[model samples]
Target chain A: MHRLILLLALFGYLPAFTQYKPLDASTINRIKEGVAEAARTTNTISSDFTQEKEMTILKDRILTSGKFFFKKEQQLRWEYTHPFSYTIVIRDDEITIRDEGEVRSFNTQANRVFAEVNRIIIGSVRGTLLDDTGFKASYTQSNGNYIVRLTPLLVTLQESLQEIVIYFSKADFTVDKLELFEPAGDFTRITFSTKKLNQPLSNEIFSLY
Target chain B: MRSFLFTSIGLLLLLSGCQSIPPRHLTPVSHHLPSDTFLPTAHCTLPTFFSPPTFQRALFKASMDIREHHLTGLLFIKMIPQLRSSRCDNDTVSLPAYRIVCSNELGMTYFDLEVAPGVFRLNYCFEPLNKNALWRILETDFRLLLSPEAGTTPIKTFVQEESNYLVCKSKQGGISRWDLYSPMGDTLLEVRGKSSLADPSWISYAEYHREFPFRINISNPLIKLKLSLSLLSLN
Candidate 1:
């Protein structure tokens, strides 16, 4: 959905003018290396996710749950199972979206925001967020999870997105939860569970006519 | 010279005569109440739609089709009351009413407005939708949709037409709304227009909620646009 992707872009943060405190160099290096190692073994991943969109004005959160899939070399599928029927699949630089029996396909280059969101989603899944120099990152640990807080540096991005907070399960270094906070204080939280790693996935699963 | 001046004025008047109100039309209209059942009430009861209950708030899953642009999102509508300088004619001072806010699921605000006796304030609107023409259209639609004064003040007229439909037309401030009701006195349709004009870019309401018809569809044929809304929750 363009809306969902736009929401993702609306939540994106790049390192520019931010108040985020940088972690020590040693701590940052360790996290970058650890995430890289863990992602290398994750050839494919399939997980169930629950997304909660909290709107502060109405003081309510809308809930939607779906299935997510990611494969190496830029392939992803996100499908919602309830409230409404919608599906989005990204293979390489192409994006295919199906809504109410209408299937539309377009290249990621068509929309800058969409492309950025695609990059961030794929990067998050593959633990490659450390590769993006646009965001200032801070690392912290609590309980059994490692947390990373990303803040945008540019004024324009800072106006749109406040922060991107990600939580990693210390056991396997896998992402457990992702939160996108907007400048208006509204936020979206996505929690992943029942993840399967390195399992073979057919290319047909990303097919959409 | 005098003759030439008179001719210019005559031409201007002729050109102005060609201008007229926008067209109004409807379908599935073969059913309506008979004209003989026409009646009048001291004050209109149909205006309660404009004045919602105390702390009125509702959530809706909304889909809007504006030309080629299609948008689907959750809509939140809240009515907050305010104490105000009353606008009253004669000895009866009008009571203040609530302000209405419309926003999407992500808290992106659409517009904030209020309509009460001698009060109409449009506080905010999304920039892209704030164009003079578009905003005029939206303002007219909301005014027609939410103005209680439209159905209260003027000389009220009611007529039942073919198809067992009772039509009530209320006029105030040159604005008029024809509220079509079923035989059971339930509102089925509301069409707004200029009081003196047959068709003034009319907007219509349909597909009311089952119980009180809270969920409804609004369509403007002139713009070829439709907005569908379904109640999700109430607070």
Candidate 2:
């Protein structure tokens, strides 16, 4: 199920290194407030995403593209349509996956990995990860984006994950890209595009069936 | 007194029957072909599917079923290029290096391994698959699937006129392996090895595309493991 988390976290923006500097305390507070306010009003989100994964042993970067969907409370659907077809839907502590033509379901509370993925992805979409005590967060500004770097403080997560960097648009406080770095020099970046927020999403999309 | 003697005899028989029985070892080949048709072939060549000369890399949609667990993922295989100075004249030289990586649908790796003749290195493996027995099983499976050129081992050939197929038998490390091929020996149909316990492990190939098998299924009944690979693309 690590793949499920990766496909969800891989929505990313371009890595054009513009001038970046540390944000002042006041600005940081304002950005946080803005993001929290945005999260409160955003009841739904739908977007197309592109993901890239880099590994030392691979001859080239693995590229994948997918669609992402989220609703209020705890409902999400991450679907990969490129290279291969895979779909993962999470609702109310349950995960349903569809690979090729096979379908399987698992309870998040019964599996540690699934539980973690559920928490992380929901926290990410709700803009609540910044306040998570499991990580230490730092703030920076680059051109029109606020970069939040979160370092894992939990020993278990630190074994596999080094840090997570989230790029939020200054104009709307919406996340544009997310990058996850591993201690083993592997990383995944996901960029979201064509984002539609607070739009009416069909209830059938979250069905376990 | 007679009842006591019968109980003792029963206990003794039970203990004798329960004495630890050694596991049945697998043989190299097992087939029921007639021995009269055996021929001493001077030369043997592997089919194009097993030949590594023209293959560089490929990708597949892979699935493995072991015990009660099922795993689906992407499998990438790349042949490592050897340096010019390491070239050898012997037909059965050390096997060429091949790097294989299996990852989940989205990109989380299950394991990464580098395999060659007498050289097996596990670069990375997921926690659940880190068992020594599992790794050894994978090593043996890959070694058999990606065998070296056929000339490296002395082989005896037999022709089954009724079945219109040829069988080549080769023994290594005292285990006999048999390869079943078409009459012309251009396409490999199946590979099987002998076993002392149950049915022999076997690999079957089908759905050829451009002289390569698009579907490959490997089964080891003793371990209750079945691994299948379907070609996705040639990378």
Q: Summarize candidate 1's per-residue lDDT along A90-135 as a digit string, tens digits.
A: 9989988776677878887764435655776788768888678878
List residue ranges in candidate 2 displaced over 4 A.
Answer: A1-22, A109-111, B1-44, B47-53, B84-95, B148-151, B159-164, B171-176, B182-184, B193-201
Q: Highest DockQ: which candidate? A: 2
- What DockQ do you compute for every candidate structure? 0.11, 0.25
Which of the CAPRI classes, incorrect, acceptable, medium or high, describes model 1? incorrect
Write the residue-wise lDDT of candidate 2 on B1-235 in tens digits: 9999999878755653442121122222223334464433324444445446788787888889989877777887878844334355634433567888886654566788887655678987766678886776666567667763345668766555456566667753323466777766667787765322232457788998788899999876656778899887774
Over A21-121, each residue of candidate 2 has an lDDT whose tens digit, in order, gives: 67789998898888888889889999999987767666556677899999998899989898778888999888888877788987877644446556766
Interface RMSD of the predictions, in order shown? 4.4, 2.2
TM-score for candidate 1, residues paired by index: 0.69
Clashing pairs in 2: A10-A190, A11-A190, A11-A191, A12-A190, A12-A191, B28-B175, B28-B176, B28-B177, B29-B176
Best by TM-score: 2
